[model samples]
Target chain A: MFESADLTILAGLLSRYLVVLQAQQALLNSCTHFYQLEPRLARWLLMTADRAYSADLYLPLILSVQQRTYNTADLYILRSLQVAGCSVHWQAANDKRKFF
Target chain B: MIKENFFEQNHLLREFPQDVQQRLFPLLELISLPLGKVLYESGDPSNFVYFPTDAIVSLLYVMESGASAQISMVGNDGVVGVSLFMGGESTTSRAVVQCAGSAYRLNGQRLKDEFNRHGMLLFLMLRYTQSLITQMAQTAVCNRHHSIDQQLCRWLLLSNDRMPGNDLHITQELIANMLGVRREGVTDAAGRLQRDGVIEYSRGKISILNRPQLEVLCCECYAVVRTETERLLPWVFQKGCTVKTTEASMSAAKAD
Candidate 1:
């Protein structure tokens, strides 16, 4: 019974590599479009994203994903370190899970 | 001369802290994943984990009657063997290469050793595992509730996003096998997509002419999977991964 969603998990991670990248580009394009069509809505989204605590890390990755020529090796190294820090944070979260 | 740094495009290797990645580079075996090649069949103990650079692999759930349906698709963004890490030691599904391209295969023992460290590599993999769980859950919902046309669209979008080009080299029979539907159903759904000008299908090659329309016509399953994947594992969110940088650092490993 461990078929526990095998294909979904693989595709989940795999397809998102494109989805997130393309979606970020698409969202940017839509934002630019919205800025022209509906400035308030565009501003709201920008503000909302800014409030997210981890947006600092995510926003640059999204921006870099958009840039056609930016070197990613450096970004990959930094992101790995940042993510590793989160895992120790994950261990803390796992410990907290015992409470519930 | 054997090429260098080809694995840099692979996200798993790229995401590894440089030193950890450097340690694994020499052991990597870059090989061609030809179309229709089975990476592993049910119950096979995984000997290697493949990081697809430009290929696509479909995991299919086979029935006792020999019928099967694709459970998931793995592209350059993912590795072929997850069971190796999940403590399963084996998988019951069949992994077949859908696209003809290349991948870097690392010995399973090496992956196990790295994973055991519980450091950055293990951390990243655990996060990846979360996204996979979301995807698996969504697939079940989509399979049960969505239309055949919608399924075809999702499957096409998945396969299309995996490889480098716009067109996919696939046949209706193969699509049927993956979707666990009849050949006639795939032909019919594909015909509708072609007629709507969303895709151009000719001689087993599908070229996506309009992705927006396909997305619009697709069910919510695709969107749900995409959003959750980004939310759970944002590290893989990047483009132009194949672009080469710092070949000097990469090539230094060759002498070792």
Candidate 2:
């Protein structure tokens, strides 16, 4: 096995392999799980989040979600953030609509 | 068959008690929304609440570099220009017509007047606003994690839901602009979808050939948006309407 390289080289190679494998596995898992659900609904969730203003910025929680492939738990947390954010919007809508 | 029709289509407004509907309905005026129209540019003072009847509007935020990505889409199912009524008096986002149709426009003063009344209408709009924010937040997540193809599928579905036609009249360039990606990415995604028989594109139009397959290829972001939108604003299903049957029907169709 190529595992017998100098210690530093071996560590670098292993880390690289791990990253590649992680990426591949993430894609495969997302594909499999999403394939199980209705396409429009699944697709909607992805695009919906992309449309957020802070989408370009990283949120600590969202970062944790991104560390893994798309998962139900990640989606749940995303929904919670959406709810909280929306509550703010809800307040604003009510506030703005209050003008006489 | 006037702007009131547009107001009635807004789930939040429709769910309001009759008294609330009466007060708000009188303030709404029918407005023609043409394709490519900008309701207001980013940072402009907000002045109206628009409820689209058939139109699809996109909320886009631009950077100093002039790059922009859509923050959300509003259709008959929702309202636009919440910032006007939300007390912000202005928004950093731009509202543009994603699909050409019509909308019911409520004057800002009148809308605020109604909001001040503080009843079901206020509660409904606020809840709906929460749903919108949820959409914005989730869009950020999806863009970071999902592929362009999955994002395209979700975009198409949302547009299709709002549009009266099956074919979407939009260019890849516009899509790239909305996704904040290069045009080449959209081209590649479109090519893949065409090859997969999931959609057909000619020039600026894209027609769905297999919605079910497209859904399978999409990520979980679509579901999150729908679920959040549903939970934050339960009225999306319509009064007395059951979503379970719709869900079953869709599943059965997909199975077939």
Candidate 3:
């Protein structure tokens, strides 16, 4: 439990974090329009890893891939990322996790 | 020179305080904007600010590869070339006429002078700019999260809100460019809407048949922009409603 003054300071820090996150998102959104898909995907993955504080990402790809058949393009992009030194491990049916 | 009453058609000009109207009106030039006309390219100096009476202007951010995506749109309810008073002489985005119609344009210097007056116009312009920023931010969010189908619904509703009628004279190719998606994606999404009887598309025209249904189909981004716009510029929407009521009564009187 935080004291009243401490809580106010924490709230202020959280709001500042939100503002920075929103600004970064807006910048990324515009930059994605200009940049190539490979670099953009790498940047996104790096950011995701940084935010999560973990190098490994467990993505449920099969379910989403089946729903959107067009994700073949996404798969190809991911493959390129793997070739670019980002290790990708695809798990089996029972354990639906794609580690990147 | 346009008639004095014509200014009222532009929500921004219509709601201007009486003194500001007097000072600003004479400087305005009524110009016809043709479809696909580029108002300004990226990094080009803004010479004039446009107050669209019936036209819609799309602010597009273009890439080095020539691909472009619309960041936001401006219609009668707001002004274009906001960078003039925002203290930026040039903008990175290009402004293009999305719909061909007439608009009143004021020289950028005159606008700056009025803004420097530190009066109602300053507050109004700041509020309008805030709403425009909200729209741009929401567009970024929508592009990342929403499906093409939901985006089309939001786009149609937003465009329809700006115009006086249901018809939108734009092609799927143009919309595809604006949304930064493939033409086939827009075609597929539009086909679904047409089959649902929410809209009718033929040639380059799309007529919205059910607005409520369109709203239902749209994502939350549309509502977010709308609420922000209404909150920032209450007089614009409120005065528009009152004007519509007055026009209805006038028509009824003529019939009687």
Q: Against the true structure, whose TM-score is highest? A: 3
* Candidate 1 local lDDT, B2-100, one digit each (tens): 345566566667777777777787788767777899998877887888888777888776655687767677776677777665455667678898776
Cα RMSDs, all models? 18.2, 20.4, 10.0
For candidate 1, the per-residue lDDT at B63 reads: 55
Instruction: Please provide, for model 3 over B27-95, each residue's C-alpha lDDT reduced to its tens digit, 9 standing for 90 to 100.
Output: 887777888999998888889999887778988888777888888888878888877665567777889
lDDT of 3 at B252: 46
lDDT of each: 0.65, 0.65, 0.74
TM-score of chain A taken by itself, candidate 2? 0.30
Candidate order (DockQ): 3, 2, 1
| lDDT (tens digit, per residue) of candidate 1 on A51-94 | 67643334343343324112222322224343334434545767
Largest lDDT belongs to which candidate?
A: 3
lDDT of 2 by residue, A1-100 (tens): 4433464354444434533332233233233323323342344345545666643323343345334223332544444444344434545668442101
User: What TM-score do all the candidates reach, one by one?
Assistant: 0.66, 0.65, 0.73
- Residue A84 accuracy (lDDT) in model 2: 40
Task: Give the alpha carbon lDDT tens digit for every residue of B73-127 in model 2.
Answer: 8987778877666555666678888777677688886776666555566667767
Task: Kindly report which residue pairs in candidate 3 clash with one another.
Answer: none
